[model samples]
Each structure stands twice: as structure tokens, then as C-alpha cells.
Target: MPDIVDDKSEQCIRFLLDCLDAHRKQHAGDDAPPPPFFLGLNGVQGSGKSTLVSLLKNKLESEPHNLSTAILSIDDFYLPHSAQQALAASHPQNPLVQHRGQPSTHDISLLKSTFNSLKTRHPVALPCYDKSAFAGQGDRTPETTWTRVNGPDQRSIDIIIFEGWCVGFRSLSAVQLESKWSAAVGANMKPAYAGRLGKLELESVTLVNEALRQYDEVTDMLDAFVLIDAEDTQYVYAWRLEQEAALRRERGSGMTDEQVVSFVNGYYPAYELYTEALRRGIFPGVEGRQLVFELGKDRRVKDVKKI
Candidate 1:
């Protein structure tokens, strides 16, 4: 994995150190700064946000300062597995919220509390969701098993790497939402894809935007946002397929290629709806430096630019 970061990790870590220095300055007053500077990393599925963050975390802990850092994945904040079943049942008419990939499925309240505890220097048992559990239906690890931050041996975190597919996503305005569906009409696109879900695609687009409104509570904490962008959306399917293949090889059980395609399709809507805003820096709560990594179809770094 060192080979993976050889190209850009140094520059990335240097940028991180600069952010930390500024953070230290901002908190030089009566109130001490929170131990960790918050960083949000965003990318579509299979776009390597996790890998980039891991590399980033390693460097943050290896410096002359040897900063202690922690990571939180938005996926781990997914609503309880049972709650997922209930959500799907309640929203039978809207398939987008019927599954976990869409924006509305997370328990933002839980995430909010966990993030707050960390920010306030309170003890927290960070929740972990096991996607491999429940016969692959997935479930959250019980509280008993959570890694307790602020434990006797654990150090207070000096950096938080908040990463996810939709980390920096902000909802569009009412008019903007209307314009999307309206534009679809003008482009000879239907308001909704026809199928069992019927208007769910259209309805869910609106639903996701509504859910994103609450996301600012989390994203506002970010002092920096990093984007791991695929060269084209088409790379999503191939990358996801590759991931599924690896999973199968390891466990001898996992989604087939056809299943992988379907799963990735569930997330396709948000990627289509949101990536442009990210590129434009229109997301609210995006402050400090923004970093963009453009990855080629083969998943190699094509370019790294700081904005």
C-alpha cells in the first residue's frame, strides 16, 4: 500500500499539517481547541476514499509530532439493521430510502452524538456496523464491542478522518431540485425510471436532498474536505466489481457481478445528482482547503490539485 501513496501522500500530509497549525492558532484563546482537527473525505463507491484516508491517518500518526488520529466512516453510522427493515417497510413506495445506499438510511442522530462526544472530549464508544454480518444483510456491532475512545490506554485524538461516499454532500435548494426534474423533462428524460419503483426514483431524489439537509450538522465540523474522484462514473461499476471479486475470493461467498451491478446502481443516483456540486465547491460547510484527486479508469492517480 506504500506504493499506492508514493505519488501524492507527502503533499497530502504536508497540507494536513498546515491545517493543524492554523487550527492551533485559532484556538489559542481561552478555549483550548479540540484535540483533533476534523477532516471529511468524500468519494463515490469504489473510488478509494478509505484507502486514501488510511494512508493519511498513518502519516498523521508518524510525524515528528506523532499526532494521534481516529477515523469514522459514514457507512458505520447506517441505521440499525432492524431499523433498515422498518424503513423499507414504511417507505415501500420509495425504493431509494428502501435500501442503505441512499442518503436517508443513516441514523444521523447517533452519528451526531458520537461526533459531539469526541468534539467535547467526552468518552465515546464509536459504533461499528458489520456489513458482513447477518448473512450479508449487515448489522451494527453491539455496544459491548465498541472501541471506547478516551479509554485508559487510548490517547485523545488530535485528528478525525470522517470519510464516506457522501461526506460533503449538501442538499440542493427547492428551486434547484425542481430544476433537476424539470431539466430531465427537457432533455427527453422521464421524471422517473419506470418499473416496480415507479416514481420512486424521482421521489427519492427529492428525499435524498431532504436528508442531506441534516448532514450539515456533521459536515460543518470538517476543517478540510478531500475528494477522491473517478475519471468517469463508469469506473464505479468496474471498481465495485473488482471489490466484489476480492470479497468472494476471501470468503468464498459474496455478490456476483450481476448483483454488484445492481448494488452500485442503487448509489448511482446520488453520484449523478451530487458530484457536480462538489466539483463546484457549492456544498455549504466546506471551509479551509479542498483537495481533489482525479483517478483514472484503471484507478491510478491522474492528478492531484488543491483548491
Candidate 2:
């Protein structure tokens, strides 16, 4: 968590602070403290989001800003090990539901309740998920170990940063789903763009799409959004490979290149299916609050668009 500000971090800080300024202006006359500004951040896996979050939080919590920021990851709201196993058991035939990477694997009720609690601006323990638990299958860390914030005695939270690979994903209608699926099926046959969506059954993808609808309950709460888009979604595989290679270098053991490919394959279908919808825009009728960073295969920003 070094307080380092690189070019990307500088751009993000500018966007986020502008958002904060707008939020404060909106509540200029209010007596009660403005509710914690909710910011939704979405990035493709292995896109350096975690590093960006750390840098952004540091900037907000120190020096001139001195804002109390609480970080929450959608990954922390994932189903516990037992629940995830049960999900896989129930949806034995649906490969998407058989793991924790897709929409249906999250604990939607818990997420909703957490958001509700944050809105109250009261003491709440942020949920934590241990991805290393149960030999990397993952589980929720115990409540006692979770971080507590916004208490009467503690610094009141001013901003809540909710980030995840699929934070602001919107659900699709049946027609849209079918159109995307059919197009992906055609694309999959060719070697030009190798993606995972066409390999999954339409019924399986539909189940995930329906589950995504539940996430809108949380998405609507976001006051602002940041989308870290990639020019090629397939770059995720190479990015993840580099991540695991670094992990193995430091930890002596980690997923191999083949396992990394398999793991990413599990989540690639959602990227293929929904990333376009996000690129088009997640917040319609509301402008100036959303920021999109289009990144090349090298993970450098190619363009910045404010929507």
C-alpha cells in the first residue's frame, strides 16, 4: 500500500475527487452529513485494479482530502465455501454455476443487506473473503476478523469504494442474450477471436443473466462509476499468467499456466457476454459521473471517455 501515484492513479484521483466535489455541492445546504459517496469500480481481472484502489484510498485518506474511505470488494460478498458447493451441486450441468466466478455464485442477500447498512452510515463490519482459504476454492473470513468502520468513536466513513471485476454489470433481456450468444457461437468457430461464451449452453448463460438482474439492486446505489475496459478481453489470460508467475516467484507455489487458463476460462464467458453492454454505458440518462479507461493489450490506457 505504498502512497505511489503513477499516471493511471493520477487520472483516477482527478476523476474521483471531481466526483466528491460534485457530491458535496449537491448537499451544500444539508445539515446531516452527506451519506458516504458510493463509487463503483469495474475492471477486467488482472487489470491492476487492486493497486489502483490502494493508491486511491491512500490519496483520499491523507493530506488535503482527509476523507474516511472504506473499501469493499464484491469478491468479499461471494458465497461461502459450503454455499458455493451447494450451488454447484444444484446446477450440476451448468458449468458457469459450478464455480464462484459468475453471477449466480454470489450471495445477493448479503450484498443487499451490506449496502443497506452502509446507507445508514452506522457501524458496520466490512465483509472479507479469503481467496486462499480451503486450498484456493475460497470462503468468507470470520466476522471477528472483519474490519469495523463508521462507529460513533471512529472516523465516519466519507466514501465507500466498491470494486470488482463485475461490479456494474447489467442484466440482459432474452432477445439480447440470444443475439449475443448466437453471434458468439459464430465467432467461436473461427480462429480470429477465441472466446468462451459460444462454448457454454444458452440455457446456462440465461441462468447467469437472470441472476445478474438481482445485482441491479446494488448497482443502482452507486453514485459514480469507473470502468477499466480492455481493447481485447482475451488479454485477461496473458495478464493472469503474468500475475501467477509473479505469485509463484515469491511464494514458491501457485497455479501453473495450464491451470491459469482453465481458471480464466471459467469467467471468460461473462466478459464475452456482458462487457459490450458496459462499454455502451451502464448509467443511462445520468451523465458526467461515469469514467471509462480504454486499455490496450499491454494494459496501458489508450483513451479516456467520461460518460
Candidate 3:
């Protein structure tokens, strides 16, 4: 990937900087330093979130708006290798839990503890998950290898970029889930529509939905949010294919086209079930706090709006 600052980064930073300014003003009268501004960035796989994150960190930490920033990724919170294997065994009938892409595959307690510790301005060791471990099934890297922030030698963090593919997903009620699932089945049966949800069993989807409820606690902590929206969700397949193609060319080893499709299949169910709800808006009633970047199939911005 080329190092470029395009419309996505510019619009994202503009909105986030405004939110940071407001965040500082809220603590202007306080005697102590304000806690880090927690911003949630949600996007689908291969949506350039990682690239955008790099640009955001560089801009926030440099120039006149000098501020310390720390990144906390949801990917880093995945369960340990052994625990993930156990989960897969227990839920053998449920393909959603047979892999690590879904909600239940995470160590939520560790994530919550880390979030609470960061709020207190204490030294915190950020978790790291190594995706290459176990032949790409992934595993939590040893704690000794984790990154420590807010230590005496490091500058105090002023911003926390909490980013993930599912950062702002909200759980649905049973009635709502049934309704959505029914609609998906109906739509997919038609020749005009090709949908992923209908390919999944309701029981399998429910298992993931129930596990998602626990994530609401983390969502409540976010001060603001940014969503990189795709015009056609199916575009994710192409985007991911492009990424793997680049990887294979650069390193001479990567997932084959078939493997890439299988990997994305594990994730597309959640995208089908929850992403529309997110697109409607995650920060309801809190106007001007959530920014959305809508992109076309070409991966260029079509519009930037506050939802």
C-alpha cells in the first residue's frame, strides 16, 4: 500500500480533532489532566482502517496539536489459543464460534480491565494478538511482549483510538433478530439478491448475537465514533482479495484465493446481521458525535456525513 493521505483520512481527522477540542473544553476547569479521548473507529475488513489509523496518529502527535495517542484494537482482545480451541470444541455445531472472527472468541474481561486502567492514568500493558501464530488461526502473544503506555518515561496519553471491524455493533432483541433473519432468507432466495445471512442457521447466528451483548459495556465508554461505510457490502470480498494478492506478491506466501473466501465467510455473517443497524447510527440522540464516510465500490468517498 502506498503512504497517502486521501479524503478518508482528511475527513476523519477533521471530525476527530473537533471532538477532541470539545473533549478538552469539558475538563477545562478541572485541576487534574483530562482522561484520554476515547474514539471508536468502525469499518469492514480491507476498508483501509489500519492505514487511516497511521495517518491519524501521525497528525495528532505532531505539529501544533501535539498530543500523545495510544491505539487499542479489538483484534488484540481475541481469546488465547487453547481457550479458542476449547470454544470451538464446545460449539462444534455452531460454525460462528468454530473460528475467531465472531464476538464470543474474545477475552472481554481483559479488555474491560485494560479500558478501566487507562481511564485512571495508570501504567497499563496493552494486549497483543499474533495472527500468524498457530498457522494463522491466531493466538494472544505473551504478556511480556505487550506494549506498556502512560509510564513515567512516556508522555501521558491524550487520545485513545479504539478501532475494530465491529467496534460499535449493537445487540438485537430476539424478535428483531428473527425478523432480520427472515428478511435475509427471503431476499437471498430471490435471484436478484445474494446474501450471506441466509447461508447461516438462526441458532448459529443467535450464539454470536448473545455473545455480542457483553460488548455494549465497552461501547458505552466511547466519547465519539467514526464509521467507514461501503456502498455495497459485497465489495469487501474484492477488497480483501486485493490485499491478499499484494501480500503474496511482496512476501511470496499468503492465503490462496479459496482460503481468502473461506476466511471472509467467517466474518461476513456479522456484517450482514449487525452493520445495517450500525449504519442507521450508533450514537443516537448525541448529535454531531458520530462521523460517517460513505464509500463507493471504487473505494473512494462518495459522501461524509454526521449521523
Candidate 4:
């Protein structure tokens, strides 16, 4: 809030702190959950998720909360490039399985163990994924360089800012997928499912929904959830395009424009489905613990509302 992110980050921190303080009051000491007060953040690419986490960490650590905060990202939990290739090979026809953007691409078991260590207040080496590793295909960084959280000096962590594009997403039922799911794509939306590919898309959606069930362990442990929601959700494409353009300017090379479009296609389906679930308050315990910050075309907060 103070050093980075947008002005609305201050407001987000205030709301988040209020929620966290209330949780601590209600469940302190032995009554509290094993993990610290977990705050899950959900946002599309280029929606400032990373910057907001950095600003929130700075603000919380600087404030008088008497807190040691740690960070865990769903991005950091992606399976190594080799494992990802194996997953694709196992399900050759499933579009979702052919890429790293879908729910099944993560190592949920690793994430669970990380959460378990946090729950025990033990020193845990958080996992990190190198987006540029494996010649830009992506892989996990070596364990020695991982951040060791909650050491003797830092003592115990009071909170964890768990964030990613799909942090709090819930799996849909098979009936829901075949029935009302396509409508979740909303108007003016055209995904990869056109003509004959529509059947394969539906099959891919079914497979992806099943894989999402494993993440319930992580989402079930959340004390609070927040969304940096783009008004149309379609803006994710433009937002991510700008991000690639900047990378191109900086390194003079990155994903080609066509490659960027293809990459976005890999994840856009899930965004469409899960955003609808969020709007319906379908995520377990999301009712009062959730807040939405709606952003406009320029990525500025247009409204903040509790769901």
C-alpha cells in the first residue's frame, strides 16, 4: 500500500486487517486453526496480484499487528516441466491436460505438505517455480534456494497471503458442466470451442472439473478470500498482452503475439467457469469471508463489495 500497488491497495489492506483481527479474536491459541490466518487472493493475469501481495506484506509487517507474515503462491506449486509433459502424454486428447495452466498441472500434494508445516508453526521452505526455467517452459527451482519461513528469529507467522489466479476456485458437478456451464462463458466470449472442437472442449471441461476437487483441501482452510476481479473478465487477454509486450521491450524477446494468445486460451476456460461459481457464492464458507474488488478496463478499482 505504501511502497507499491495502486491506491485501492490501502483500502484492501484495511478491509483484510479488519477481517483478520476479528478471526484472531474469535479463535486464538489452541482454538485457532493450525495454520496462520490464511488469506487467499484470486485474480487474473496482469491484475496486480503479485504487487498487491508485496504491498500488503510491507504494510502488515510495518504495522503494529505483532505479526510474522509469509507468502505462498499457487504458481509456485506448478509441477516440474518433465512432470507436466508426462501428464499431457497420459491424456493426449484432453486440451486442459496438454498445458500447464489447468487445475491438474499443480502438485497439490506438495502444497498440502507446505500448509501442514505452516499449521505446525515449523520452519518451512516454500516452493518456487521458475517461469523462465527449462528454456522458458518452466520448472521448479532447487530446494536450497527456497525461502525458509518461521525460523527462530521470525518466530511464528501470524498470517499467510496465499495467492494465485485459481486460489479459491471450486469444482463443478458433471450435470452443471453439461447443463448450465456453457452459459458461464458469458456474452461476447469466444473460447476455443467452436464447431467440431466444441465436443472436445466439453470433454476437457469435465476432466478439468474433476481435477479441481483436489484443491478443496487448500480452499477449505481459508479464513478469508479476496478477488481482484476484472469487470468483464475478458480484459484478461488485453492485460496479459500488455505484460508480454513489456517483457519483449525489456529482454527484446519473449512469447510471440500468437504464443501469448495460445497461452491465454489454456486458462481462460477455467476463469469463465470459476468466476460464475464465485458470483453464486458456491465456494464453501465464501459467503461472509469473501470480498470482491471489481476493476474496470484500465485496471482501476471500480467498486468494492462484500458477497
Q: Rate the local accuracy (lDDT) of all candidates.
A: 0.77, 0.88, 0.87, 0.79
Select the stronger candidate by lDDT from 1 and 3: 3
Model 3 spans > 4 angstroms off = 2-5
- Clash pairs, candidate 1, are 36-158
Q: Which stretches of candidate 1 lie over 4 Å from their true place?
A: 1-7, 31-35, 185-200, 282-288
Writing each residue's lDDT as its tens digit, candidate 1 over 1-307 gives 1123325566778788888788787777846664568888887677666677877778778857698888999989998889998988987887677677678889999999988888877788988999978777788999899888876677887788898888888888988877766655455445444222222356667877898899888887778877888888768888888888888888898899999988877777677667888876634554557888888877788888777
Give the C-alpha lDDT of model 3.
0.87
- Total clashes in model 3, counting residue pairs 3 or more apart in sequence or in different chains: 0
C-alpha root-mean-square deviation, each candidate: 3.3, 2.1, 1.5, 3.5
lDDT score of residue 276 within candidate 2: 86
Which regions of candidate 2 are displaced past 4 Å?
A: 1-6
Question: Higher lDDT: candidate 1 or 2?
Answer: 2
Residue lDDT tens for model 2, 151-239: 78898888899999999999989999999999989888888858889888899999999999999989999989998888988888988
Model 1 lDDT, residue 181, Cα = 60
TM-score of 3: 0.96
| lDDT of model 3, residue 205 | 91
Residue lDDT tens for model 4, 182-275: 5543332656432222334577788888989999988888888888888987788888888888888888888888888788877877776778
Where does candidate 2 have its weakest 10-residue lDDT segment? 1-10
